[model samples]
Target: MADETPGFELPLLLFAGFRTLIDQLHAELARQGHPDVRPAYGFALQAIGRGGATASELGRLLGVSKQAAGKTVDRLVALGYAVRADDPADARRKVIRLTPHGVDALARSAAIFEELRAQWATALGPGRLRALEADLRAVAPLAGVRLDVPGWFGG
Candidate 1:
């Protein structure tokens, strides 16, 4: 059975689609022994960079509380994907940066993304895929959207 109520079906479908893709990649990561590969960690990795970021900036970017961001950061650091450094401008603050191992993992993920894009293009045809992408962009949710992901429709 499906929801027959007004304006409910599309959102459900969207969530299911997102969840499915994430689950597929996550399962693959798990198979490869990549621990702590949750979506939250992914979002945090995307927020950090070569130099890194403060917890408050990550919280603001991800629409989470500072506490939640700190937890995610701590997890990444523990897993060796990130490192915390004292803020040059403010001694009390700290910034997060991707480590060398983190860069390697990120590169692997980028390869996966490229492979997925090729498969999609072959299955859907370039023209139709572009149209589909434009349609999704038009309907995308603005609230709580994370922009740090490697690429959205642009990659």
Candidate 2:
């Protein structure tokens, strides 16, 4: 069945669902002993976890200005979640790497995400959930949305 509003689009529906999911997930994460991290920080962790990246690269990945990205890096570094080290390839350049604590946090967050997904599956039913996922994946590219940025809606 469609939503109540006449001519309500698919994107808006998806946005509402996604917003709710992320808000709940963030609450769950805070309850799970990760109160310091926001969704934006999570995105930074994911980006940095894929090997390492320079501040400029992270800026691009995060769809933020270089200054904003730098501030984010500063926050992460201050919190001991990431480190800024000189890039081996270019001494003048710096790369961000997650610390052991950051690594552990990422692992924990991933587990929480899986748990949440399972809960969704249970609520929505396996077949319907799978179809929803497949349909979203099919239409995702048409919308020019970036799949990797969990904080896109929140930030």
Candidate 3:
């Protein structure tokens, strides 16, 4: 049974929709035999690919404590998607980089996202999709949301 709410809040509705899309993306990834590749991993890969970053810098970018960022790096290392190496200028600090496999996975995931966007356009019509995008772009800066994952949602 569905709850008969008087009115739905726009932000909550948008969040639900976003979650649905993310869930679908994950499902597609699992179907394609990707193992343990969570959305956070994709975000991290994007951050590393843009430029190598230390766990502390990643934490600052992700709006997380350094410890939390370290844990994410540990997971990426375990999954063979990222590696930590000594910084040339500062041997005491380690920098993270995406492996070739990680790059391939990110590319594949991007392809999947494009397919999903096409499906959305088919369902909503190109005009409406474009309008929604415009609305988001106009409103995003007003929300002041922080990125908890490196590159998620254009962070």
Candidate 4:
């Protein structure tokens, strides 16, 4: 359904739903003894998990202001989930990467994500969920959208 006035489309609705799912999953993970885990932290963790990305880059990836992004990193750093290293190519900037601890945390978070996906499938039926995902993927390229959140939306 398209928006009557502002012209919202299927992609926007799909994206909103996807974000809600992530948020809910994060909340569940936090409830499961990962009080530090949040949606923003997940973005940070994924960026660092990818290797060789600066704080600014992570910020861009997370769609957060640089200051907000820095705060997220700082929080994660304080929690020992991430670390900053001097960038080899650009001495002026630092690249963020996962510590071993961070990697372990990400692994735990990933397990939670899998569990949630399974739960969703059980509720919605795997066939329906797969079809929905396929429909989203089919229109992604035509709309200049990339739902993939890895490394600049996998660009």
TM-score of each candidate structure, all chains considered together: 0.77, 0.83, 0.83, 0.70
Using TM-score as the yardstick, the better of models 1 and 2 is 2
Error of 2 at 51 (Å): 1.2
- Model 4 CA deviation exceeding 4 Å by range: 1-16, 89-91, 141-155
Q: Candidate order by lDDT, highest to lowest?
A: 2, 3, 1, 4
Off by over 4 Å in 2: 1-5, 141-155
- Go through the candidates in order and give each one's C-alpha lDDT: 0.74, 0.81, 0.80, 0.74
The whole-model C-alpha lDDT of candidate 3 against the native structure comes to 0.80
Tens digit per residue, CA lDDT, model 4, 13-126: 767877878887778767766677766577678766757467677777666667867888889889888888988897999888888778877887788778878887999999
- Judge candidate 2 at residue 41 and give its lDDT: 87
Compute the lDDT for candidate 4. 0.74
Model 1, position 61, has a per-residue lDDT of: 69
Tell me the lDDT of model 2 at 83. 95
lDDT of 1 by residue, 60-110 (tens): 766677887788888889999999988889999888888887776666666
TM-score of 3: 0.83
What is the Cα root-mean-square deviation between model 1 and the actual structure? 6.0
Q: List the residue pairs that clash in candidate 1.
A: 52-96, 53-96
Best by lDDT: 2
